[model samples]
Target: MSASAAAAETPAATPAREPILSVNNIEVVYDDVILVLRGVSLDVPEGDIVTLLGPNGAGKTTTLKAISGLLRTENGEVTRGEVRFMGENIANMAPEQIVRRGIFQVMEGRRIVEDMTVIENLRLGAYTRKDGAAAVKRDLEMVLDYFPRLRERTGLAGYLSGGEQQMLAIGRAMMARPKLILLDEPSMGLAPLLVKEVFHIVRKLNKELGMTTLLVEQNAKMALGAASYGYIMESGKVVMDGTQADLLDNEDVKEFYLGGGGEHRKSFKNLKSYKRRKRWI
Candidate 1:
């Protein structure tokens, strides 16, 4: 066949890959009255670290809870829209069901069982999986390799330092062998060096293990550095989203989140109106 004829016979390939996890216009309400999330939506592609950045009370943590089905514990519910994991609508699924479906959430505040040994708390993460005991044992070693400090503090979770606690939280999530990991404020309350180390591990896992991660964080500088894409939420809605480069270069994000705006910086409190925040988004 002629070159032109061969070109005509070739079909165009789709460029976009399907997302592993998607939150579509979800609205979360608490105690039947307080509406927290207002139509927030985002996507996490397989094997990518997608950062969800927002200030306190921006519904960032609430979004993670809704995805992992942890909202029920706090009397919060996704009243509208859908949370789809691997093309399955899981908005109404129980937390354990979500975990069983290969989603694990590393909640904020390091919710480790104080009395349990570090290894014991981690073992609980794999409880929902029917995988063989050997697989669980292997993953335990892998988790420890990722956070060696946990190996040293095998006694009790209560004795771990704040940074060690955060590491244990993430290590526990890894033990579940989750397809998607929802990390809430992993850098919270950690020292600068430890914060960098934590992000390094998160990035490494996403690359080495092909793990899909949705990271909710306030540390914009570090988060963007590790993420492939980012979404900025405010006042219960996703106000902006873009590739990491786009967000890092944004003037408003620089001034406010990345600490680069200098005198040009503006506080989010002053930009309550969407019109004011739209310039950078």
Candidate 2:
């Protein structure tokens, strides 16, 4: 083989890099009265999908808020530890500054402006960048390519169906060209078919676009299927952390979250009794 041909055939060495986002032993308290998060920590490496799976009020959303610097809204503050993004400490950074550092979030409830056009809403997501007009246009096209429904509803956002609204919410987040995107319940309150569609797009984004994701999901089964790693939280604490397969095979997870025959019913009865006694105390 010719030397030039051999050189062309050789693969370039991929660099070993640290996680794009890292949370270390963070604690959050609200109004000095309630503790919303209890020493939570997680990591999202480049091109990997990590999921936080939990029931309601498990501090899933609170953790995301802390990472995004939105904890101040509820008079809540991170009292311990750090949130590192790209080797920089983001624990005290402003929300806009956090976004500028390539972390974006598609909050729960598909928080799109119902009164605005889809295109206009998408434009607002890129407000942090000043000189990315051409790049933004390209990125918009990329988002449309991923969510064709958004392309069709370019002129209408308020009138869209629930599924389309969710798509637009995700597409708007993509317009920022973030390296890592935090998705909070993208499948909430949707039909089964639409849930499947949203998960399809999510997996495609991680695999094809090389985008790292930290998904907070209530649907444990579906989230496990889409994510490579998972952290299971209960009452503001991470109870289990493992690979998707490990979680699937876990006897405890199957008994509680995955619906293992009549066992969960028995467990629920015990939980109810415990709660009743605690309330009495």
Candidate 3:
């Protein structure tokens, strides 16, 4: 057989699946003067956990707010580019509309309602649902199943411990039954043990519920472990991105983000602020 014929007989590789969410070169500005995100872009594949990692003030949280349309509430605007969810342009949409369209954001600091009961806070997540009470009730039970401790908390949500409040925050997002859940610093302020438990549940949610997750975390070890892919941001731009293994194995990543660099390396503050390896650029 001829070489051309032999090559033609070989089957082609399967195409990669489309991402459920795409942030395409989005630029966000606060109060029409302060530029926070500069041409940021990322993709969240369906039914997979993708993580965004960076130091404080790297514009990670702002990226999430832009997607969930909470920016308008804070006088922020997406001045350029597009944010597409499920192939629809949703940039600058109202927050409520974004929630109704199956996108929910669990804000940082576990923004559970302090005065209300745990059940009330969870139900508040369903406020945008047109589904009947019975459906909402079923999801409420489902959320409690994931966080059984929440089931036991009948009193005010305010009184719960930090870990329990984090659980409540995640449970509330589950109540929305969203197609995509944006988790900002889910590991923040939790004990080491509690952080492990939370990441375990996050993995479980991805596996069993098939929920597509976009996670922003400072805990690089935990985040990269749970995520299939990761993006590292610096100065409002994605400086590096790769599959979990690729990122975990990179020398710069290991030294700077993973705490693996030896004594010769200076502090992270000096490294981050003053220096950039040529490859990173």
lDDT of all predictions, in order shown? 0.85, 0.79, 0.87
Model 1 stretches with alpha carbons more than 4 Å out:
1-15, 262-281
- In candidate 2, what are the lDDT values of residues 1-281, reduced to their tens digit? 22223223222212354678889988888998788788888877788788898878899999988888777766788888899888888885677888898889899999999999998888888888766699888888888888877877756688899999999998888888788899999999999889878987887887787778899998877777777778888777776788666776776666556665243455557867765653211
Candidates 1 and 3, the one with greater TM-score? 3
Q: Higher lDDT: candidate 1 or 3?
A: 3
- Candidate 2 vs. true structure, TM-score: 0.86
Which residue pairs show backbone clashes in model 3? none
lDDT ranking, high to low: 3, 1, 2
TM-score of model number 1: 0.89
Model 3, range 1-281, lDDT digits (tens) per residue?
22223223222212286888999999999999999999999998888888999888999999999999999999999999999999899999999999999999999999999999999999998898888999999999999989999889889999999999999999999988999999999999999899988988888898789888999999988887788788999878888898776777776777767775454767768665646543332
Candidate 1: pairs in clash: 255-261
The model with the greatest TM-score is 3
Candidates in descending TM-score order: 3, 1, 2
- Runs off by more than 4 Å, candidate 3: 1-15, 261-274, 278-281
User: In candidate 1, what are the lDDT values of residues 1-281, reduced to their tens digit?
Assistant: 22223222222212287898999999999999999999999998877788899888899999999999999999999999999999999996889999999999999988998899999999998888788999999999999988877888857899899889888888888889999999999998999898888887887787788888899999888888788788999889998998776776777788678775556545667667744637433
How high is the lDDT of residue 5 in model 2? Answer: 36
Query: Where does the lowest 10-residue lDDT sum fall in candidate 2?
Result: 6-15
